[model samples]
Target: MIKGINKMLTKSKLEFLVGLGIIILPLQGLAAAAPTEMTKDDWLGKLKAVAPSVICQGFFEDASLKKRMEELKIDNDKCISLIPASFDKCQTQYYSGLPATMNKDSAAKWGHTIGECIGTDFATKYLVSNPQASTSSSSDQTTSSSTPSSTSPSTPSTSPSTPSTSPSTPSTSPSSPISSSTPATSSDSQSTDISRDQWLAQLKTLAPAMICQGFFGDPSLKKKLEDRSIDNTKCVNLIPASFEKCQNELYSNLPTTLNSDSANTWGHKIGECIGTDFAKKYLLPTATPATSTSSQ
Candidate 1:
């Protein structure tokens, strides 16, 4: 009886150990099958969830992404499971905490980005918000889009009995005027864009306005101005907040020479160098002693 009881107890203990081992063994290997983990897409579905968007934009231009873009090409679209990840990056970067005023400098950058991937309308609207967008051709902001209709209707046929040969008709009128109008308008527009870029660069730099004008206003200046007949009043009405900030930024770039009784002295020197009225009009109002920045 004693032997039978000991044998039964031993077997029961062994069975319990075996069962515990079975449970504990799998727990120790929690990551052994991690290779089968679902991807960002598999978990989030077709559109990436918030996590992926942040990873794309926050990590865009990261060296790894650039390498991935080049090496994978079309395949790159699928490599990370986020299709066309670069665009995800762009949207994130563009809308992220942006400055309200799209000044000449800001507009150029946004325009370049827009040109590469987005529709033109957003880019033009962004530029219009900047004071520097005034290079004579912002008027070209006009554009319209068309989408294919979901349903199509059959075309009606003309009467079959219509005479095959009609009476002699005068030759189609020349469209030379239409053709002529486009080239001049196109050339003028191009000129204005070129000018806007030049002006943006100069205003962004330490270059004095006269020096900048000289550089941009050459025969090429026409090309730099974005619009020739910019309506300042209209511009203010369009984007008053940005316009106000951009105007402040424009003056911010002016020379430190404006900070002195020496402004009068500096103006004389600048007039001698550039032979222009810029210094007189630009510097006189803002001139003050060097230490007076806070008082203003």
Candidate 2:
């Protein structure tokens, strides 16, 4: 009878141990599955490394823009240089505003914001026709100035001829009265108006593509998305919605009139806003588990 009781006790103890092991194994698995959270510094370091690629990729995605950059001899190194101190401050402020700890998802979401900021900065600084024009203008001015100096000796001989022609020149000028300043002013106004319109239109078309490319081009960001099982196609599909949200938030506040400078400024801001929105929606992990449990 004592032997029988001993056997029953041992069997009961074994069953209890087995059940405990079962419970502990799942708990261990859950702990392992939880994402490791990073501090602000870690996140900032990662973003700084990743943002330049994203910014350059987005800014040069347009074939013409890429070609123009090549012509200007602007390379990725120059692209990195365009990241301003203000942008560093922006990133610091952004991460400081977030929770003390960030998971991969949160890090990636904010990474997009950093990319947007840098890209906008790059576009604002380098995307204009001005840089190329200025370069060419300098050379032209140098050549034209030399020509005038070379021709100055002939001016004395022509002085007598000038008096005779000057009378006719003034008469013809008064009759037609072409105000050089007026035509230039009119031409400038039309050019500015057209450029502003064209810029706004191009921005509308290109902003989405830029945001999408920037988000995916960064190696770290792409890995984060991959870890979440979010593919490029999924994110691409989300762009229209993301872009529309940003546009509605930003576009209304645009000044009634936009010149080249103002357009560049606002365009940068708009791109930044779009990137923030896109990341918030698709990059950040959803609280689906909590919602599902709550519903149940």
Candidate 3:
């Protein structure tokens, strides 16, 4: 009876071990299958591949725009060709401030923001009402070719008037603005005339106020800052200094005139730079020390 009980006990222990192994094998497989974290370079690589096609599709998918392009004889290929240049311009603005490493969720959000920037840049440059004139000119050419020779002289006269009117329209519009906003134009001209040193000094004085307002006023970002224990005072004190670094990096190719649109663009860029510096300095998770294990 003792021998039989020993055999049964040994068999039960073997079955328990086998069952535990079966459960653990899948868990191990699952752990191995888990995704590795992506670095900023990896995300940027993926963005370059994806952003152009996405932006082009958005423009081409618009029924009215597509129809207009068809009428204009503008090849969709032309739009595709412009994407590389647009993406290059926008990539630095959006991606330069991102952390080196990101988890899946954060990487996705960053990608979405960059995609929007690229789309805006591409649309601003390529999608214009001016291209419609090409279609009109082509129609004129076909009409002249089909008409009698006596009528051709009239077409030339009408074409000359069209070009003359085009130049006048732009001249009158600009003159009206210049006449109405004489003071504003003078101030703009004065700003253009300032030396670079004076401009930098002015920017430095303005940086603190702009940075503080942008940082604390943003609802989503404010929560993130609060979580990091970064309040208004700390932000004002610490972040304004980052503007100098950002200026050195981004302002080397500054436009001659810093108009309202350009100012807004640079403001966003500098703000991003400051935010990036702050994150690198403070927001990264601290590494925990590993516990020592004694060998048996």
Best by TM-score: 2
Scanning candidate 1 in windows of ten residues, the lowest lDDT window is 150-159
Residue 56 error, candidate 2, Å: 17
Residues 79-107, model 1: lDDT tens digits? 22331233233334454543453333332
Local distance difference test values of all predictions, in order: 0.23, 0.37, 0.38
Over 109-132, each residue of candidate 3 has an lDDT whose tens digit, in order, gives 444344434433333333322455
**Candidate 2 clashing pairs, residues 3+ apart or interchain:** none
Model 1's lDDT to the true fold?
0.23
Q: By TM-score, how accurate is candidate 3? A: 0.32
CA RMSD, predictions in order: 33.1, 29.6, 29.0
Per-model TM-score, in order, reads 0.15, 0.34, 0.32
Better of 1 and 2 by TM-score: 2
Instruction: lDDT for model 2, please.
Output: 0.37
Worst 10 residues of 3 by lDDT: 150-159
